[model samples]
Target: MLDQLSYKDKNTFLQNVHTAAILTYLAALLLLPLILAHPLYLLGVFLIGILAVVVSDAAQECLPFLVMGIWVAVFVMILNPLLVQNGTTVLFYGPELPVIGRLRITLEAICYGATMGVRLMAIILAFALYNAIVHPDKVTGLFSRFAWKSSLVVSLATRMIPSTARDLSNAREVQQMRGVNFSSGGFRERLKKYSWLLEVLLLSSLEGSLATAEAMQARGFGSRRRTCYNRELVRPRDYLCFLSGLSALIIGVYARFAGYANFSYYPQLDTLAAASDLIWLGVIILCLLLPLILSWGWKHWPYLRSKI
Candidate 1:
């Protein structure tokens, strides 16, 4: 799926960064979605997420996910007002619905819903960025350094998803060539036809698993200490990145505790803690943009000398 995106193979600073640094950065990004409830802060989070997506070169792959996230936000906005009947100011009243009777939409509810929706979107985008930047193999290998057996299980599970997807696509194409119409059929007919395709997928997966087991056994996978190829060296730059991420996380946590990042949507929105928040916001923005800045600077460094 990510292969469809431009810059899938582009060498970026992030690709060379230590896995620990990436994990630290992700942890900091993940915390923002959980703590901040203000619309402005959520919007900031969303923008940072967009920046991450762009830097990771996964714009094409991110579009569908972004659309789905927007749909989810819309769904939350519509549904929240129906279920939640709190707040004083009512915008409009709707006719009594089946299960939820007497729907009353209020300004407070709408604002609250908007906050929740944007929070959801921000979280999704953050993970999408992480997925684009971090390879699963590298993650498994990192885990293997600490716990080999657990890493092996995770690696197998991760491999299964894409492998199964590929098998399904191949099965669909072969079936289509043989005039097995999966699309233009009655509901029951399509169900039966698709069931056949699923059956093929299952069989192929089982066979593949068995073969993998045989190969592992033949190679004596568990007989000795497993060695990892492609060892990543931890450079000074990686240490700097990791330290910066850790500092940001600590500061963010402190800010949250100090109520600098607090926002309320119910019973009228609370006044934004502008002074402290702006400081925290700047820190987050710097943390997020650092990777992009480094990558761009590295790419253009040689060209910079010609003009100089």
Candidate 2:
């Protein structure tokens, strides 16, 4: 699916950038969201996640996961308040339940849950975008330069996700053709039908694994020092991008450690009003957005040059 949607023109900055730079950029993205607890900052992270999905050309594949993330977020918002009954500002009172005495839904708990939900959604979207942009073969080849055994393991692990999804879809289509009505069935019946689907998928995976093993053996995969046919060179622009990402990561980490981006929601929601916080926020946003800017600039360089 990603192969089908990927841009035909392969001369973009993102495609040319060193894998190390890409890894650094992704690491910063994944870490910044986890460190910042402020709702506004979290919103920035969420927006970055959305931007990543759009830039990666995997929005169609990511939509379902985004919807599922929303559902999970709502579930967390509802469930957290029940489990954690802490806070002064009570919105409602509930009957005393066994094992847990009194139950009250407070504003703090709700806020905490919402923050947690947003954090989760941002992380999921970020990873989805990463998966779309970075192919398993690229990762495998990257690791192969270091350790062939590790490379093989990473290859299998990364390929398993898309392969399993594809197999499941194919299995469902074949089953439907054979008069297996998965949609129009009771809970038990649906479960049974899905079990058969899983069985078929498992068989398909085994067959693929066998074929892959045979191919690897035929190619003498581990017999010699592995060499990549297509090597990505780190250009001057790649250095600039890597340095920018590293600097952003350092600043973001410093801000987090210095408590500039900290927010509390347990007993009461607390936020810092220092001017430095806002500056750090802007820096983080720029850091997250730099790649998109570079990609778009390279994408339209010819058109921009024509005007000059």
TM-scores vs. true structure, each candidate: 0.84, 0.78
**Model 1 Cα shift for residue 54 (angstroms):** 1.5
Query: Model 2: per-residue lDDT, tens digit, 39-69?
Result: 7778887887788666655677567668889
- Flag clash pairs in model 1: none
lDDT of 1 by residue, 1-308 (tens): 43532225445666667888887877767777787665666677678778777765678767777888999999999889889888778899999988878888888898888888988888887676666677677778888887989989988887777778889999999999999977797999999999999899989988998999999999889999887769988776577668766776776677677877777767766776588788887886677667667656656686532322
After superposing candidate 1 on the true structure, give the runs of residues whose Cα lies further than 4 Å from its correct spot: 1-8, 93-103, 175-203, 302-308
Q: How much is 94 displaced in model 1, in angstroms?
A: 5.3
- Once fitted onto the true fold, the runs of candidate 2 whose alpha carbons sit more than 4 angstroms away are 1-16, 157-214, 303-308
Give the TM-score comparing model 2 with the true structure, all chains together.
0.78
Output the lDDT of residue 6, model 2.
34
In model 2, residue pairs whose N, Cα or C atoms come closer than 3 Å (at least 3 residues apart or on different chains), thus clashing, are none
Candidate 2, residue 19: lDDT: 76
